[model samples]
Target: MSTLLLLCNQKTVSDTLTDVLRSVGHTVIVAEDVFSLRTKTAKEDPDAVIIDLPYVDALFEDIKRMSPRLPVLCWMQES
Candidate 1:
């Protein structure tokens, strides 16, 4: 299984998703803020990433400045 890095601002959301991914056998690293997100991505180089889309544009801009090849999955809630 591939490692999954999750970037979310909500603690409960990050915890829940981390637990679920770990249960499914993927190593999970959850970051609750932008600083941690950058640090983790640099240190871990995860196979996949899941992020909440609230700050998608800003985040992607930062990500592009840093690493354009990184895989990102922006999560969206359906109303």
Candidate 2:
């Protein structure tokens, strides 16, 4: 399995995802923000990223500014 990076500010969500991925035998890394995402990418070079997109509209510019495109899994919190 490939390495997956889960980027989410919600600790429970990210931690749960990590547990599931690891259970399936994929290595997982969790990052809480764009900065941590970059830092983890530098170290781990994951094959994919999962992010919560609740505020992605505000983050679009920054995401686009990133050098390379990464596969992303998007989610939102329900109220």
Candidate 3:
């Protein structure tokens, strides 16, 4: 029962991910932006982070700084 921090700005994507993760017994915390993401990351100390934001690289660096050992999974759109 690991807690996961989900950073997504899109409503549909966030909702879908939250539901799916919850169904699999993983606790999901959704953050729509970097501010919330940082706050939640500190408060929750989630096992892993799933990011689907506009600035992936920058966000990833920030997250790494906050929690170096924490696992991160990034989602990107192919264009």
| Model 3, position 74: C-alpha lDDT score | 94
Cα RMSD for candidate 2?
A: 2.3
What are the Cα lDDT values of the candidates? 0.79, 0.73, 0.91
C-alpha lDDT of residue 13 in model 1: 75
For residues 1-79, write the lDDT of model 2, one tens digit per residue: 9998777878887788889889999998888777887677667777877778577554544543552576666678886
Could you tell me how far off, in angstroms, the CA of residue 46 lies in candidate 1 after the best superposition? Answer: 1.0
Residue-by-residue lDDT tens digits, candidate 1, 1-79 = 9988898766777888888889999999887688888788778888867888577777767765677788888876554
* Ten-residue region with minimum lDDT total, candidate 2: 58-67
Best by TM-score: 3
Between candidates 1 and 2, the one scoring higher on lDDT is 1
RMSD (CA, angstroms), candidate 1: 1.9
Worst 10 residues of 1 by lDDT: 59-68
